[model samples]
Structure formats: C-alpha cells, structure tokens
Target chain A: MFRAYSALIRKEFIQVSRDRNMLRLIFLMPVVQLLVLGYAVNLDVKKISLDVYDFNRSQTSRELVDAMKAGDYFIPGEEGQTKERRPLWHLADRFQDGSAQMAVIIPEDFSERLTRGENVTIGLMADGTDANSARIGLGYTAQIVDRYAWKHTGLSPPIGIRSAFLYNPETESVYYMVPGIVATLLTMVTIMLTSMAIVREREMGTLEQLMVTPISGFVLLMGKITTFAILGLLEMVIALAVGVLWFGIPFVGSPLLLLALAVLFLISTLGMGMFFSTITSSQQQAMFLAFFSTIFAMLTSGFFTPISNMPQWMQYITYLNPMRYFMTIMRGILMKGAGIADLAPDIIALAVYGSVIFSLSVIRFKKRTE
Target chain B: MNDKIVVQVENLTKRFGTFTAVNNVSLSVRQGEIFGFLGANGAGKTTVIRMLCGLLLPSSGMGKVAGYDILTQPERIKRAIGYMSQKFSLYPDMTGRENLYFYGAAYGLGRKLIGERVMALSERLSLREFLDRPSKGLPIGWRQRLALAVSTLHHPKILFLDEPTGGVDPAFRRTFWSTLYDLAEEGATIFVTTHYMDEAEYCRRISIMHQGQIIELGTPHELVKKHRAANLEDMFVDLIRKRESDNA
Candidate 1:
C-alpha cells in the first residue's frame, strides 16, 4: 500500500512539474494574490474628506477642525476645489461628485457654550455610499468632539473611555487580511486540485485503467488527496512566509499548533474536493463546482465581512460553513496568539466537520469506483 | 499452453436505464488463445470489456477471470488480469518510464522490481528511445507501445487489449500483432477487440457481435465459410446488414 501510495504521489508531482501553467498557478498564484489582495483588500478608511462649515468661526471650532486633521484618517477639504464657496446645501452634490465624504457644521454658540459650561452641539453629516468609511468617520468625529469638550470645559466626563485594541493595536487591515488570505489560498488550491484529480483521470480515461489494477479505491484516494494535502500545506507555508517576511505581519501563536490545525482544515476541503470528483464526470464540471463553493465559502466565512454584520439569517447560515470556523481560528491564532483552550469551540467544530465531510466523501468515492 | 480456461462468462447481461447493453452474452476464452471481440461502434463491445475488467458491474451475469468471480471476487480478478483501454489512458504529461513505474508500483511491485520490468519492457517493445520524453508528444504508435508495456508490466496471465492498434500504420500494427503472438506463445491469454478485420483474422477465434449479441463465433476461415462471405470484413458487413433488416 505504501509503495503504491508513494508512486502515485511521485507521479502526481511529475505531472504537476511537467505542466508549466499548473506549476505557475500552484506556486505563484498565492504569492501574487497575497501581494495584490494584502494591499488592495484594505478596509482601513483613510483620507476621509471632512468639509468644515464653521458658522461661529471661533478659535474653538478652528481647533476642532485642526484636531480632526491630526491623524491620517481625515483630510480637511480645500475651500472650493470644484466651485467657489460651494453651498452647504450642495453637500449632497459634493458627496455625489465624490469630493467630500463627511461635513462638520459647528453652531454659532460653540465658544459661548463652553464659557457658560453648557452643552453644545456640532452637526456632522457623512455620505453613506461607502458605509465602512462613513461609519469609521463618524466614530473619529465622536472621539474628537468629546476630547475637545473636555479640554475646553475644564470638567472631565464622569466616565472616560480608555479602551485599547487587543491583538492589533493600530488595527492594520493587512495584519488581519494576511492570515485570512492564507486560509483562503489553502482552501482554494486544495479544493480545486483534488476536485480535478479524479475527474481528470476519468476524462482522460486513465481512471478505467487504474480501476483494473490491484490498487484499492482507498489507496488511490489516499494517494491522490495526500499529494494535494501536502501541496495545500506548502501553499500555506508560502503565504505565511510572505505574510511574515514581506508584510511584517507578526505571527503571535504557536507555529506548531497552527500547522496542526491546518491539517485539520485540509481534511474538510480535500473531502469536499473528492465529493465533487465523484459527482462530476468532467474536470471542468468539477472545477466549476469547486470554484462556486469556494466563493460561497469565502463570502460566508467572514473573510470579507464580519458574520455578525450579516443579516441574522445569513449569520446563522454561516455556522454551516467550515471556512467560517477556520477563519476565526486563523485570525485568533495568528493575531491574538490564542491557545486551544480559547479556541475550543472552533477547533471542536472543525474536527467534527472535517471527519464528517471526509468520511462521507470517502464512502461516496469508494462506492462510485466500485 | 495448457487447455485450462482463463475467462468464462454465462448469460452475461448489463442494462443502463431501459436499454440492455450486453444482452445475455456468453463466451469463454482459453489459456494462450487470441480471442477477438468484433463489432461496429456502440455494439456494446467496450461495455463488455469494461465489465470483464471489473471497471463496471454487470447488471445481471456470472463470470470468472483467472478463477476469480467477477461479482464476488472483483479485487482478485483485478489482481490476476491486465487491461489496456481503447483510449490512450496513460498520463500524457508523464514520461513513458514514469508511466510504467507508476503502474508497476500500483500492482505492488517494489522499486527494484519495477525498474527491472521497465528496463525489460522498454527493450522488448522498442520503447527505449522514447521512454524519457513525455508521452503526449510521442507518436501514437510509440504511446500505444508504452501503454502496452504498462498493461503487461505486472505479467498477468490474461491480457485485455481494447483496440490496441486502432490508429497505427500497417507496419506498426504488424509489429503489434507479433508482440501479441509472443505474449500468447508465453502462455498469456489475449482477449482483444478491434475494428480491423485483418487483425480479427489473426485471432485464434472471433466473436462477431451485432446489436449487443454475438451472432457468430468461430475461427476466421470457419466464420467466412459459414456466412458464405468473401472475407471477414464482408462477413461482418453482411451480418450487421441482415440484423438491421431483421429489426426493420
């Protein structure tokens, strides 16, 4: 059995190495995707245009505008880039033309309210077209206003927020995105390759030849999926190396634990690939199914959007997606250095899902071959 | 070769949906005999070979290959026979040597044993020159030789060649036939399917199938005389034509 398994893996590697396109796709795809998506999938909203409308023209209001400009998150809008004295009513137009993402209006009594020790109001309008930036811009606005009020009034708030972000202090989106991409790349490569493995043989009619041999269905499946599983792990390593070396993303957890869980993750994906192979006779069909499922898994996995932000029903549906648990596990391990105890639920869920999917696919594959 | 039977099937039948592919087919092939399975396209020739090779299950039938039941002992049957499919089934991206070694190991042969077999088969089949290059770019004749070597690598007693020389030139086909003769001489039972009637004439016995049933079974000269046809091709055409007319 070992001899047959080893030979099958060696043959797969030879075939993979011989095909230049597959070689490039296998080794280069993750690196290229990491470079592109690590930089492009940035959710960190910066350079938000804040059009300041100071009705008071007071020193306090000017200081407030300057405070908003202290960080890279906000850039004060020029007086009138498009038109001179752009009307405040044209706020909608400014947002429509993509000139300003947010506008702040300070009331006339802004300084008087502070001297009198009374509460003052400032109006901040944000374009909700890009909801993520809009929401973040609003949050920055609240922080700046609260600080300004406390500084000017000489009276501190009864309760102050000294919250510090855990795992990621500056909340760099790349730090979060790199690990997610690693998980996604592993899933994509393994599922696509394994899904195509058996189907390609069947399409080329090599499967019929293999079936006539003394090799059992179990050996064939093990040999094929083992090759892909190793390939998937190699892709993960490449993505991780790029993540840690190029992106300088810190790996906070036990590397051994991450590697162990990655194997667990591969079981589910490889099983899914095998299931697809049994159902589809053609490689193209298997590839389409794999692609569609990967996309579905990615979308629901909270890789792009947080599952909590999804509709309640969609959030419930995400529980069925193994990638969702893997995603959380990846981010937890890589960012927070989370141990298994902290990740027991997710790890347990993955184990259950992996075994069930792997066994089901294996059973179906054996039946199909027999 | 002794007179022991290697392949025997009785009332062999396979059905897909409502169509009966192999309709109660029955035939037996003896050790060292060259058995020709002849039919037009879609006459269920490939289906029958698929069943015999254990690639597909017979919907209803009883058969044995090398003393192993096709139904109850398919794994043993697989171990005891060799199958070269009609399609060039070896991995195209792999070199001929790699293909041979892979199949050799798949049959549980060790590394030294596979290497020895590869060396011997490459020499025997004149495949040494093309053994190092990928099989995809090799000429069809060379690829067929490589596939034949792979099928025979484990040295099974029974070999099933499905149109083993389908698109080969006459010279290559002659050489291929000589190889078959050598295998038969070495006590390997050959069950072959072919489109070329000349190749059919080379068979020790032939079964002519039409519409999923064997209408004639005998040696080439006996079949030609029994059907009163000029040659095997003419006899094959007359039999298929008569069957079509009867159906009409």
Candidate 2:
C-alpha cells in the first residue's frame, strides 16, 4: 500500500510540476490575495468625511469642531458649508450623496450654558447602511467629545473607566486580518485543488482506469491528500511570509506549533476536497461545490465579524465549522503569542474535526469507487 | 466448472430505476481465448463489460472473474484485471513514459520492474520516439497504443477492452489485434468489445447482443454458417432484423 501510494504521489507531483500555470497560481494567488484582502478588509473606519452643522458661532462650538478634526478617524468635509446656509438640511443631503459618513449638529447655545454650568447636547447622525463602520465611527466620536467636555469643564468625573487594547495596541486591522487570510487562503487553495484532482481524473476517463487497477481507494485518496497537504503547507508559508514580511503583521507564536496546527487544518480541508470530488461527477460541479462550501466556512469562521455577535443558534452552528477553530488557533498563536496550554480546546476541536471529516471522506471515496 | 474457465456469469442483470441495461446475460470465456462482445449502441455491451470488470454490481446474478465473486470480491477482481476504454484514458499533459510509470506504480510494480516494462513496451509498440512527448500531442493511433501498453503493464490474468479500437487507422488496428493475439497466446484471457465487424472476425468467439440480450453467440464462421448469412456483418444485421420482426 505504501509503495503504491508513494508512486501515486510521485505521479501527482510530476503532473503538478509540468503544469507551470498551476504551480504559479498555487503560490502566486495567496500572496496576491493576502496583500489585497489584508488591506481591503480593514474595519478601522478612518478618513470618514464629517459634515458639521454648527448653529452656535461660539468659542465652545469652535473648540468642538477642532477636536473632531484632531483625530485621524474623522475629516472635515467641504459640503459642511453651503451658500444658502441651510447647513442642517445640507447635512442630510451629504449623507444621501455619500459625501459624508457622519454629521455633527451643535445647537445655538452661545457659550452661556457652559458659563452657567448647564449641560449642552450635541446631535450626531451617521449613515447606518454599513453598521460596522458606523458603530466604529460612533465610538470614536463619543470618545473625542467626552474628552473635550472633560478638558474644557475642568471637572473630573466621579467614576472613570480606562480601556486598553491588548495584543494589537493600535487596533490595526491588518494585525487581526492577516491570520484570518492565512486560514482562508489555505482552506480555499487546498480545497479547490484537491477537490478538482479526482473529478478531473473521472472526467478524463483516467479514474475508471485507476479504479480497475490493483490500487485500493484508500491508497489513492491518501496519495491525493498527501500531495495537496504539502502544497497547502507551501501556500501557507508563502501567505505567512507575506503577512509577516510585507504587511508587518507580528508572528509571536512558536513556528513549530503553527506548523503542527496547519497540518491538522489541511487534513480537514483536503478531506473536504476529496469528499466534494467523490460526490461530484464533473470538475465544474466539484468547483462549484468547493467554492460554495469554502465561502460559507470562511464567513462563519469569524474571519471578519465576531462570532460572539452572532445569534445564539448561529454561534452554536460555528462549533461544527473547522475554519472557526482554525481561525481562533491562528489568531491566538500569531497575535496573542498563545502557548499550547492556552489553546488546548481549540487544538482538540481541530483534531477531532480533521479526523472525523478525513475518515468520513475516505469512507465515502471507498464507497464511490466500489 | 473447469479451472480454465476464467470468467463465468449466470443470469447477470443490471437495472437503472425501471429500465434494465443488462438482463439475464450469461457468458463464459476460457483461459487464453480472445472473446469479442459486439452490440449496437446502448445494447449493454459496455454495461456487461463494466460488471465483469468489477466496476458495476449486477442487480441479480452470479458472476466470477479470476475465481473471485464479482459482487463480494470486487477489490480482488480489480487486482486481477486490466481495462482500456474507447475514450482515451492516459493523462494528456503527462508524457507517455510518465503515464506508463504511473499505471505501473499504481499496480504496485517496483521501480526497477516498471522501468524495464516501460522500456520493453515502448520498444515493442514503437513508442520510444513519442514516449517523452505528452500523449495529447501524439497522434490518435499512438495514443491508443500507449493506452493499451499502460493497461497491460501489470500483465493481469484477464484484460477487458471496451471499444479499444474504435478510432484507430486500419493498419494500426491490424497491429493492435496482433498484440491481443500475442497476449492470448501468453495465457491471458482477452475480453474485448468493438464496433468494427472486421475486428470481430479476429475473436475466437463472438457474442452479438441486441436490446440487452445476447441473440447469437459462436465462432465467427459458425455464426455465419448458422444464420445463413454471407459474413459476420450480415449475420449481425440478420439477427437484429429477426429480433425486430419478432418484437413486431
């Protein structure tokens, strides 16, 4: 069995090497996608255009406007002023036209209220179409205004809360996004490549020839999985290099642990590819199925949104997604410098998922061959 | 049953939903004989070959290949046979040598043996010049011959060829049959299906099927004599016409 499997692997590698385009794609796609997606998936809403409707021509209002402009998150937009002087109405137009993502309206309290020790209110309107950026923008706005009020009034609050971001001090999206991209690229490439391998053989009529040979289905599947697993590891290394070297994303974990975990992750993904190939009769069907499933897995893996924010049932559904555990492991290791003890549960979940899926796929492949 | 009877089938049947592709088809071939299976399109020739090759299970019946039950010992049967189809099965991107090496290894032949076999087979089939080139770029005749060489790399006890000579030129087709006869003389049972009636004449025994039933089975000369037809092709047409008239 080992002899046959080794021969099969040699053949697969030879085929892959001959196809220069596939080899280029296998390495090139991850680097390109990682650089592009790492920057594109930023959740930090910076350079948001801010339209201001200051009814009060007071020093306090001027200070407030200056404070909003001090932060990198908000930029003063030209649309805040109009010849007709209907700034409030124009604010709405700015939001509709996408000229500004946020608008601040200050009332006509001519600084008398602050001198008299009366509280003043500021009206803030943000486009809620993109809930994520809206929420981040709202949070930044509240922090700036709260600090400005405290500084101007010279009053220390009776109670205070100080928040510090751990692991990623600056809240750089690339720091959080790079690991997820690695997981996703590994899953996508491994699953897509392995999924098409068998179906391609079937389509070319080579599978029937292979099936009639003395080789068992298990050996054939092992050969396929082993080849793609190595390829997946190579892709992961390339993606990680891009993440760490190009993007400057920190890799604070043990490289050995990451390697071990990546192998486990590849088992599940490669198994999934094999499963898709076995169930599909054509390469097109295999491609569609792999794409559909990988997309769903990436979405539910908390690559972008927080799983904690999902509905209770949906969060439970994520328990079955292998990508979820892999994403957690990746982020935990690369970002948090988490040790094996800290990631025991995630490691166990991945092992279980990988073994179960791999076994099930092998069984299905055998049954299909029979 | 004689020990020399390499393939034995009794009432082998296969059904897809309500339609039967092969119904109560029974046949046997002895060791070292060239057995030809001839039929019209969709006449269940491929289906029957697939069953005997252990690629498909019979809905009901008893069939054995190389002393292993088709239903229960499919893996064992697979180990004992080689199959080539009308559709060229060699990897188009891989050179002929690479494809031969792959199949040789797939059948668990060692490196040294595979090398030796590849060298010998390429020489015999005059494939040495084209062995380094991808099979796709080679002419169809060379590709078919390469596919045949790959299939027989392991030298299985029984070889099943489904329309193996479907598109080969006449000169190459004659050479291909000579290879089959050589293999038969070397004690390998050849179970082949073909559309060319002239190729059917080369088989020691031929079975003509129609609408999922074997209407006639015998040596080419015997079938011609029994049906009172001028040749094997006429006998085939006569058999089909008789079946149609009976249905009418």
DockQ of each: 0.62, 0.54
Cα-based lDDT at residue A321, candidate 2 = 83
lDDT of 2 by residue, B14-114 (tens): 89989998989999999998999999999999999888888887899998999999999988988788899867899999999988888888888888999
- Candidate of highest DockQ: 1
In candidate 1 the C-alpha lDDT for residue B204 amounts to: 97
At residue B108, candidate 2 shows an lDDT of 81
Instruction: For candidate 2, give the lDDT.
Output: 0.82
Clashing pairs for predicted structure model 2, backbone only: none
By lDDT, the best candidate is 1
lDDT of each: 0.84, 0.82
List model 2 lDDT by residue over A293-365, tens digit each: 8899988997776674467899999898899988878987887687888788888998898899889888887
